[model samples]
Target: MRRAWWKEAAVYQIYPRSFCDSNGDGIGDLNGILQKLDYLQELGADVLWLNPVYDSPNVDNGYDIRNYRAILSEFGTMEDFDRLLSEVHRRGMRLVMDLVVNHTSDQHPWFISSRSGRNSPYRDYYIWKDPSPGGGPPNNWGGCFGGPAWSYDAGSGQYYLHLFTPEQPDLNWENPAVREEVYDMMDFWFQKGIDGFRMDVISMISKGGYADGPLRPDGLYGDYTGQCANGPRVHEFLKEMNRRVLSRYDCMTVGENSAVTPELACRYAGFDEGELNMVFHFELVDVDGGETRRWEREHSWKLTDIKRVLTRWQTILDGRAWNTLFWGNHDQPRPVSRFGDDSTEENRVRSAKMLALCLYLMQGTPYIYQGEELGMTNTRFTGIAEINDVQTRNAYWERTERLGVSHEDMMRVVNYISREHARTPMQWTDGANAGFTVGKPWIALNPNYPKINAQRQLGDPDSVYHFYRKLLSVRKKSDTLLYGHYQLLLPDSEEVYTYTRTLGGEQILVVCNFTGKEAAYSLPGGWAGAELLLSNYGNPCSGTALRPFEAFALRHSG
Candidate 1:
């Protein structure tokens, strides 16, 4: 297999807004991240994938880009960003910024000009259409947050498409001018010595003729993913982007493609494909919510279902294209709570390590969200008012007000699936506000911070933080872990997940118990008495009986 810096590196995703507060001003800033660089280095992170810090109105927590070149005042100044980049590079860690060109804030200068008149110079910068005969939206598509995807512009007498919120208008990538602007903005960052980009909602850049998608049972709005994701010219535009700007720098690029399949991923990030280095497909994350609606009632996901999804991606993309391994991110619920047992302290630690061993040992670049190292679980939100996420707030209102669902029931779903769970302030210490800030936090911290804070974990050798450090250290030293061929073992097992990675004469075996109860599994042939590289449980016996949430990696060489 071909080797690259990105292929062997593990990325640490930092949601700056909730990471740490530097000025005691509630919000996390670039200086906050600058302060945490040593913490990340201690955890063995090679790359840092920062969430959007661009100038914005905070409608979608900085996803709505007001100015691609300017840094948000709340985040820090341009000089602060430059210092952060310099410090990151000085520490031998690369930094990747979030690229949110799929949409721009309605207040953006381009959008402001586009909405001024029908024949404005920037009119083609955004997707605008006349009302569909009856004086409503241009299409039946629904915004990702809620309501119609098309928001009316009284000045232009046309409705513009926004897949997310009315404040976030979709960009017209079909225009060569828009594409050039985006590429030039990218070059601006590359010229600043920043390492790479994490493209947000990259698959939705192309639209499929603005056709009406299939309506849901409620008949409010049509499916946006069906009409927009992986559109006709996506690959062509990506190739153009690669040719124009990305090829000039030795950079790492990972696209946030929520609607991609393994085949589509191959085209986007295949070995010979010049588009991106890797892609974040939502198949594993979407298991509980499915493709259409994620805010509804929780869907029961089984171990076999997870196995099927992970095995497919691991095997299919083994030699075709690279994969990105992550359990949770800024937009998803916590991993220990969603995929593992987080009901108890012991369970949280064990399962967090188990999940780490299960996913990180697979063939891919691993991404660790900020608080995930401390085994942060989902937040227990009691009321809608406490939630800070726009999507969660919209879903709560839609379900309780219009759909006639009970408040208690909808809040239950919010507790289970809300993105707010991951957006809670990072738990640095057991002090007030979890050491995230001294002043009021923009959002509430996860209440379990007293027990699960990073300060507490960093001091303990058996903590989840140390486990992750060891796991990454192990990965850094093993060529087999980076480029080995993956094979699923015990594919049908419901309680235990096992896999092996082999490169030439070197082999690494990973075993994980996904449940709270002890599971039984026999070692495969020629695997007895293998050298134990790492294990969550202390000095666990190499016996058939696996403890609850036990995970370990064994090495074999012949």
Candidate 2:
């Protein structure tokens, strides 16, 4: 086994708009990020993965990039970005900017120029196709945000392909010129001394199906499965980019690959010659939701299913390649709301600890979304109109019209599951806008911030902040947590999820009561009473009962 730089590192994701507001412009800026450098170090993070801040029309927040060369005026000037970068490295931390090259904002100069006319020099930069002879789109390939993926452009008298919202046009990776342009952007960032990038939707770059997926019902096309994902030449482009730019510095490149398998995942981040350091998989995060095609609905989740998914990933990629482990991100609902009890404050922290234990203990790098340290739960909006995310709003309307799902049921599925979940203002203190901004925030602040802000958690030793600090410290300094092998202790237990991590001569056993009731069952495999290393509920006492939601990791006596 070889050591990787990210093995024991903790990553903090910053949704710039919601992190902190320094200019009093009702939005967060680069200076705001600079102000929080010390805070990130305090939270025990080594990497600050800032979401896209490039110029855009706020169509999908900042994911759409109008110009990769210029910082959005709303985020401040390039000097401010330089200052923020300086401040970040000054604190002994690295910065990973979000690389959203898969698609560019329609307002981008290249797209605008390309769409000007068929003979525009930049026209080859994007995908444009003719409609079928009879009429309608060439095929039924649906946009990720609803409607046909192909939108007809009367100016060119052809349909322009967009995998997502109409406002974002997909780059034609099949074109070498487009690939060169993407590489140039990577070089620009690396030259600026930025550490690396968290590439947005990289796998989808190699989409298999085009125009339309083999015909399906509802007057639509096919599902997202390989339809437009993991195209044949994606790795060729990635490898080229890696050689030219990414592989140069000790750069960190993590991709947001939605449905990548273990083998390909390892190939993407494998030890010998991988394209990225790690890639995020949606398996654990979507545990509650059934694994099926986009149009199908399988709502129930099983605990055994949870164990299987986590363990399988561990089993396959243990030492082969690195993995990016996470419970929540800017795109998913809060973990506490998704996996834990969202109704009560006590349960929020309790469940958060357990969820953390599960991911941080695994064989991958842990990514902690902002506000997760405060055990932040979900916020429920009454109507779809209140939601600001384009995907959520579009899905809400489309699902209701197509599936006939009741409002309550529709809300139930997406209540807190959209990117809007982690995009809300970060709760800093119990003040207006949760101390994020002195003025009205660009987005709504989570309501529980009054008690759950970072200010309040920083002082308490038993707070989630401290637990995270302690967890990171242990992972960094302790042998077992860092280089240990994992063993599932009780695979059949219905009420508890337990496992042991061992390295060299040291071993630690972790057990958690996944439900809300006290459980007292014999140690199934006879690995009994060890010193309690850490617990969310109480200390390790073999004879004593396990309280509901009680969690503990105990070390074996030498």
Which model scores highest in TM-score? 1
Candidate 2 segments whose C-alpha is farther than 4 A from its true place? 211-215, 218-222, 290-298, 522-529
Q: Candidates' lDDT values, in order?
A: 0.90, 0.80
Give per-model TM-scores: 0.98, 0.95
Q: How close to the true structure is residue 210 of candidate 1, measured as C-alpha lDDT?
A: 89
What TM-score would candidate 2 get against the native?
Answer: 0.95
- Report lDDT (Cα) of residue 221, candidate 2: 31
Pairs with steric clashes in candidate 2: 206-231, 207-228, 207-229
User: Residues 1-558, candidate 1, lDDT per residue (tens digit)?
Assistant: 888999999999999999999999999999999999999998999999999999999988999989999999999999999999999999999999999999999999999899989989999999998888778876677888888888888876888989999999999999999999999999999999999999999999999968453344435445778778999999999999999999999999999996899989999999898999999998898777634557667666778888899889988898999999999898889999999988898899999999998999888999999888889999898898898889889888987888898999898888888888999999999999999999999988878899999999989999999999999999989999999998888888889898899999999999989989989977888878889999998654467889999888999898
